[model samples]
Target: MANGTGEPAEYEIYAIRYGTNETRLRGRNFILDARPDDPLTMDFFCWFLRCGDRVIVVDTGMNPVKAKKHGHTMLLDPVATLRDFGVEPERVETVLITHMHYDHTGHLDAFPNARFHMQAEEMAYVTGPWMGRRWFRHAYEVDEICRMVQLLHEGRVDLHGRDRAIADGVSVHWVGGHCAGQEIVRVRTARGWVVLASDALHYYEEYERGIPFAVAFNVSDMIAAHDRIRELADSDDHVVPAHDPRVAAIYPSAGVGFEGRVHRVDLPPRLP
Candidate 1:
């Protein structure tokens, strides 16, 4: 599967639904919930992009163990889920961390050889004073955040301050608001362009209405990021919302509940 760059030449995207739950904040005030399940438990999963000879995981879903302690549920087993997709954890050489949020970076330890890609500002936010205080406390896990910081100190993480291309057709853009240095990963799939919105815009509504996520460091920056995502996508359909349920339907669904089978990212029919 190795290509010219010694990475997987062909690209495939898989959508793994690791968890799902209803969020009152995301719907009633966040966006349009015209579907039967108004304020539906949108798809909460990670994305996998296989390019050339490399396998890249966009974000890791929530920690099921920590989730249960908090009275929440998870849909996939982080370890088994990727294995089912034929992706060996140790084989994942590149892991692009979208942000420092609990859901996005929980399973960092899973990718043994992964060279994590993240924004410098994101690292700054997670390690700064605002992390433990009220305004920015609830969204992150203290220990995990600290662990990521340690990883950075140990040189296991590759922090990117601005948008940079990790590989050909795969680039990381600094899109904030969801978190200080939150970013979106874009890959040139065989079909066309695919941008993993990793919380830059939680759902399509944010982009549609120009509203930022409730848990944001800077509302104005979030709004600007939304515009940036739209512009990068070129077309509305070209962009993919991180937590949107539509993503589950639009990308090929893989893996059993918790078995890690969601890496088939081929485009699916749009929801009408």
Candidate 2:
């Protein structure tokens, strides 16, 4: 099938869960106030997108060592997990980094042959005044920034200033809220256009209730990003939240054994 624009009509999108933290804290994930007993937990994920001959990875998850040091239980090495999914990191040619947060940029070196696509403003924000604050600096790792710079020197970083298409059926839109250059990915899939809302909306509830996540660069921006996600996706089911554990239950499993760990987002979602 071909999209009217001559691109493949659909792509296969996979959400690979690499790590998770079961600890719950009140008021940590949502900006709105809740009861003292309200629970909040987060899952860590990296998305895999295959459109025609193009294989684009969104965010190379944090390495196991750093994940453990930061109190997150590393389920599996993301690069190794990708290999299990039949994707060889060495052969991957394009990597779309939604932002430079530690969890999202830690394993950049794994994809040695790839050109990293990132928002130019995100690079400036991480390297500029915001980094002077401990709060902002704490979310990123110095080594990852160094590696990205090295890649830049090697002529492998493709910086985009705003929304643009990376391939025939794949595009990225910048939504600066969770971070200065946070962006969400939109891909044409069998179910229609699916938006990978990478931290733009951490959970379905965030989008449903119009509440911004607690950790945000700009609350208003976060809320606006939610709106943008809704506009881009085919429907609510077509919007995949980055850290929502419920996604595993909602989407069909990729394989029999890796039921909750890996999901096939390219397929039509199973309704409640």
Candidate 3:
């Protein structure tokens, strides 16, 4: 189990890979200089939170072709990735999109029973502010945003622009930096605290050196978001960086090299 809580049962956290690539775009300003050894590796993954038979997805890794256009080195098929993880896309009930980035919110329609959770500010930014600016351009698919808007209209989408608990041991906190409504998923495990810093701190270097992602909308807020990730983790060790390839290296690979690589919170330290 991912969380080491001594309960008879534990939450299963699966790192489903959607793609991988080297990205120079993530290196910007002084962030790369601050962490000179930081690699340009990008691991596109959608996290699965399994508590009992219930399945919740943290983010949906995108469709291949579209993902490639967005600077992803190699795009893995989301459907294929889900199947490899023993999850059926149609059975996913809840999908929490950490933000509205094209790579993170790509394959929503694949999950038939899923009701999405997103921040209200994200919707407004994508709909009103981002659409007008060149810098914010291609952040997402307008049609996909429209689909989310429709889901909101149909009452199938939950908008939480504020911090709130979504379920037992699981909560969503608004941490704006990369995007207006960007949030992180925090969960309490038997081990202690486990915080998924989905793009909030894309890699360990972002926090270790106080460097932020280059694609941020607000730099100070992004720095605060990085600090907030530590606070939510309740410790430096409990926070998980979403795209760091180091994760697969540190954690036990459940299957092949990248496949079944689960970051277990209850496990021993895999980082320096």
Candidate 4:
């Protein structure tokens, strides 16, 4: 879609790999038993969305402290990775946080000029009584949640309900399986609509193989999210899962010096 002046309402999306853990067994990733003995690469990433002169970031990546604690090796600091893309954190005006998980909510203070958009249910879920249970609060970092609270009081956080249009061709939808307020981003691109399936489907096989991720809050919601992801993308390849290393192999690199680290998700995937 384009305005009368003829500028297309399409955004360029990038999945920037910042951290990765290759020690996990496939059984640990899937809920049921699917190739229980196979090894898997679980990459950590924060997405970048740009349309014309407008820029929007998705997920902030993990704090270094959390990265070490989880045994996830840090390839590059996420903020620095954005700088590599020529996007200064200070100038970023909009950040769409996929959820309040430790991996997605770090360095809220990094983008001082940006308003963090999150699902209201997520903000509430992190602060609510259910957090008292260890099972419900395992992946959250207390410091990050506290920082979010501080930002909330400072009026720098924008919380949405179920679905919200971010820009001309960008939107976010709450899936609520991996976490109470888990969300996925959908952006219109030159190839077509693309869905950023943040934690809803960590690997393509999780969706394609009809198996949900293991760390789910609700299995039913997780299964239903697969349908939502399919509905939002133009094709199967258009849906980009949050933690798959196959992403880099499927799409071309973002640019020079970023090969294997960052890849453009807005472009059509390469054929096998």
Candidate 5:
């Protein structure tokens, strides 16, 4: 997928918001300044990447049943949303699992033919002894983890040790912090390299203000991951935060009627 210039072909990256949690946490997302009165809410998103003939999917959004169980409002079926965007979920060959969080891995079954790419350490972290503790297990669903194990046996799982390129212009980097094996995806786009900081940096403010998210396996690693995200992206604008509503406002809409629900990150932003 190289261009005439020998660089990997630039891809189109889209961030699709499928759900939101309106329950205000009041400054719970950021550490070090627990403002109990400052309300905080987060949007749930899954990213899509397209390059010529190849299509790659980032985290799969949570299913409606699970969303309701967890107090999140599922806006739309992510698979259906992809179909609306002209991507057939069944035809997608590569699915990137940033981490094992329930929201990110819930729809794995939606892409039956895709090989799931995940950090090797992440799989170990989630299935290892740490999960025995309720705090660690609370964020994950046992059935999903078990299904991944089943997929591994079926030869549908691809695990990587660290930073690895999944495609011509797409790569995943292990920045273990939010979780022991949390990763961020980077892809070359028309606007340059865009880094999808999935959960590694949930909000733009988390990276800009040097504040770690409240739930982190390693605070020092989270801080280092922030640096890595900046280094990988062309600029701050090229770094897409996972849960920030501002992403929808900053990027151009994918199409008319898709405003706020689907934003095109690969294209130049509509707002400065």
Candidate 6:
């Protein structure tokens, strides 16, 4: 990861956990798994990327109202957490919205000053006829979707196809499976290229076991995305799953006061 000057331009990455849903079961989470209904807990997170002065955020995360509606335990406000992490919402220059799912785009209004980078297909999926069916639109919030539409009208949304580089050491790649516009982030950190497998690979085991998440728009795409995540990351160990509670448990804390909730992803994971 080098800049225009040919110097190492590695960014620091942090994963900030904000909410959790503990009602999930293996029967509900893994669409391909035929195992018994074992309990599973899904945690919510939004990632932060920093290289020198450049700041980029991934996902806005679900707001209080939306979290409560879905029975998610809100641990911290995403906006507040970012502020406490020393990045203000008013100053963020770019945001990578993984998808338009309700939990991902709930608080988009908070980052009005930045250009929200998202897949063109995602914008179309949310507004297209496919969303008329309840199953396809179950994870999306109409209010947040409308807000994105408003942002598009306001010219605050940057929509593209396939993939694009967001910064010198950061890029996003498309892998539409969980949804029409699902994407994952590939970041160049000091250790290596870390692929933030947003909802495309919610749990670490999802890819390891070759299983698809149940709440998906295309099962085939979901299964195929496992390969894409590997292609983007430097190694399988560098890939970070967004919804796994194990992430917060094993990864070292980012800094003081953020223990158990925020951890530094650029550092190597503490394996047993």
Each model's Cα RMSD: 3.6, 2.0, 3.4, 1.5, 1.5, 1.5
Candidate 6 per-residue C-alpha lDDT over 59-159 given as tens digits, one digit per residue, 9 for 90 to 100: 98888898999888999888898989789998998999999888888878787789999999999999999999999998998888998999999999999
TM for candidate 3 is 0.87
For 1-272, candidate 2 gives per-residue lDDT tens digits of 35456757678998988888888555777655675357666888898987665678999998777887788888768898899878999999999999998889989989989999999988998889998988777878888888888888899999898798988778999999998999999999877999999989788888988888878888889999988998999998899998888888788988987888889998988887
Q: Please, what are the lDDT tens digits per residue for candidate 4 over residues 1-272? A: 34335875888998888889989788888766747889988998888888766789999988898889988898878898888878899999999999888999877888998998999999899999979999889989988999988988999999988999887788899999998999999999988999999899899988887777889888889989999998998889888988998898888899898898899989988978
**Candidate 6 Cα errors over 4 Å, as ranges:** 1-6
Worst 10 residues of 4 by lDDT: 1-10
Model 4 quality (TM-score) = 0.96
TM-score of each: 0.86, 0.95, 0.87, 0.96, 0.96, 0.96
The whole-model C-alpha lDDT of candidate 4 against the native structure comes to 0.88
lDDT of 2 at 266: 88
How many clashing pairs per prediction, in order? 21, 0, 3, 0, 0, 0
Q: Counting only residues 3 or more apart in sequence or on different chains, how many pairs clash (N, Cα, C under 3 Å) in candidate 3? A: 3
Clashing pairs in 3: 5-190, 5-191, 254-260
Which 10 residues in a row give candidate 1 its minimum summed lDDT? 28-37
Better of 1 and 4 by lDDT: 4
What tens digits encode model 1's per-residue C-alpha lDDT throughout 1-272?
34676754546777676776665344433534344235545557678887545788887777886776654568778667778768898988888888877887778888877788889998888778876777686778888888887888878899876889887778889977767888887777666677778788777767887776667787788889877777676467667776776666555545445333353555643557
Q: Write the per-residue lDDT of candidate 3 for residues 1-272, one digit (tens) a residue.
A: 32345553445566665577765444442454645555577676668777767667888887666766766754456667667777898888888999888888777788767888988888888888567887875577877888888888877788875797777778899898888888988877666778888888778878888877777788899999877887888688778777777766676555554543444443434666
lDDT of 5 by residue, 157-270 (tens): 998989998878889999999999999999998889999999998888888888888888889999999899989999988888889888888898889988889989998776
